[model samples]
Target: MATFLFDKIIFGPVKSRRLGVSLGINLLPNDCKLCSFNCIYCECGWNPDQYDQKINFHPKAQVKESLFEKLSQMKANNEDLDVITFAGNGEPTLHPEFSEIIDYTIQVRNKVFPQARIAVLSNSSMIHKKSIFKALNKIDDNILKLDGGTEETIINLNQPVGKFNLDNMVKLLSKFDSNLIIQTLFIRGEYEGKIIDNTTNAELEAWISHLQKIKPKEVMIYTISRDTPSDNLEKISMNELEQIAKRVDAAGFKTQISS
Candidate 1:
């Protein structure tokens, strides 16, 4: 297992492999792993217990005010901000006032750094919630994640509990008419005697078929660029990712090879 990469409520105006110089908005608590899916490949490490609770839910007004203050300081210093991203240690959509927070982030962003894009990196677990979908639509980049096409692999890797079946999740996600940048992390490993390989041709075919059905505007094909939770996990090679990108481009979908 890997050590948690971030520990603050608000972190990194740092370089991101996907988002670039992103100002992160941590919707989760400053500490703890709060999420619906405890992924094996999660850089935050695995929360096998699946105990996702809000330790400290900040008041929306306070969060907004603090953000405004930070933005003001950055503007005063003549610093550039590329993107304001919502990606904490846990699920960003789990915040009770996520929509309002997004509204507030946008307001502050426009007032201070109008050129910077507002992005939300989410796990796509709560897209079924109408409010969550509505909030995501407001962002410049709605980076949604759907790693596996099959229910078995989804359960094994993502480790989402309850009625989080792949079929239902896909059906729910289809309601989002907005162009979504779907992200899939392709990897291979063996967990508890079960072989896990999302890069397999069968999985790729299934993902492609689902992509045709969902019709996302773009797809991000990525591999493990950082250390993960499970020891059995293996990163996909660059050559393999490029091959996948070619197929995705051939299908008329915008694709980016990132790791």
Candidate 2:
């Protein structure tokens, strides 16, 4: 329903509560969507009917060109670039040329707005790939998603592919040399006839302990910020999210709450 979502490959300068005004670059196809995880809180909706949005999305070359033109215009306009982000409707890493795209983006953006930071909001699905890590290393803010700590909770919340291994996933992310920044959304609700709740003390404790091993530089925890695809999703109260933030902060890491 969102027709004029983005112009060319770049979209926004959109208002981001956490990242400030972000210049968005969607690498996936505009017509069809693709993603590794079918998250309950995805604002752009689910992946293809079967986890593959088989759209006739443009090739990587076209996407890069779109970004170049839009960025050039922004430079000429003397616009502000808070964060140059790679986030489209679906999993940005799905783009075949993900590594090259990140490299070129950094090159061009540096020439124009040297102070602007590059940020990638990833689901952490393909982080195990060597190539993916190579690109992520160049980012200023490596904000990765780890919605649920335990494998069960992760599968329930993220609803990734059947074989998606949370243990393996977390291990891969923990290897990043940078101080990984994690963003988590706590919620409790129902979908279809099933109830989905992650507010129990057991769940939170599991999440906290799991994070200790990863030892991220900072953590961002908050309630849902947008409409999720699932109807049974509910945003955790600000009070609850704050309490979680306190626990995380106590663990010797910086934590910020959106609400």
Candidate 3:
């Protein structure tokens, strides 16, 4: 079984393939994966056992304090930073104090590294909520995930919890009006006797349609860069990613390949 990647609230001024040097803020519990989607490719592993691993969501005050401490230390040492990203064990918008945290993060970031961009890596599950949407609008990089277009592909790949459907997701995302960035992860292989591949002509065509509807500022297409929970999955190569990106670029939408 795969385990959680981060064990702390504030972690890593780590090098990112897409975002440059990033400081990660983990709002979910440090011990378990708390997510709305039980994705097959999740590095934090399967979610069936997550309920048992649930710990209290860290308080907003503590998160701010910890983040401030880390940022202060980094500033003291004159560490370079490009982005302060909210990405960790699982979905970040699920944090009850998400809006407040975003506000505080902006304040702290302005004081420490005024030039650093504040980004959120969201699954778009909570974008339907007015508070979440409003808060996301305040950030520099509001990157949301759109792994599949069809409901079958979504269920097979992302396995979203609760009442989530593609049409509603499209509606919510379109509300962002090109202010947001669309992120898609392409992968191939099998899981539980079924073949899984999002790089197919049918999937790509459907995804492109959705991208056109959203009209995002940019589209980030990427593949698994680390060990996923499932052994049956395989990463799509850079060449394949570029081929797909070419199609997206031709569609008049800005695209970035993060393979």
Best-fitting candidate, measured by TM-score? 3
Candidate 2 vs 3: which has more TM-score: 3
- Native-to-model Cα distance after best TM-score fit, residue 31 in candidate 1, in Å: 2.0
How far off is residue 11 in model 3, in Å? 0.4
What is candidate 3's lDDT per residue for 1-259, written digit by digit as tens?
Answer: 4555688899899999999999999998877788999899998887655376445788999999999999999999988999999999899999999999999999999989999999999999999999999999999999999997677887788878777789989989999988999999999988888888888899999999999999999999999987788888888999999999999999988998887
Error of 1 at 177 (Å): 2.0
Model 1 TM-score relative to the real fold:
0.94
lDDT value for model 2? 0.77
Candidate 3, residue 112: the lDDT equals 91
Pairing residues by index, what is the TM-score of model 3?
A: 0.96
Q: What ordering of candidates by lDDT runs from best to worst?
A: 3, 1, 2
Q: Model 1, residue 153: what's the lDDT?
A: 85
Rank order (by TM-score, best first) = 3, 1, 2
All candidates' TM-scores?
0.94, 0.91, 0.96
User: If candidate 3 were superposed on the true structure by all CA atoms, what would the RMSD be?
Assistant: 1.4
Give the total clashing residue pairs for model 2: 3
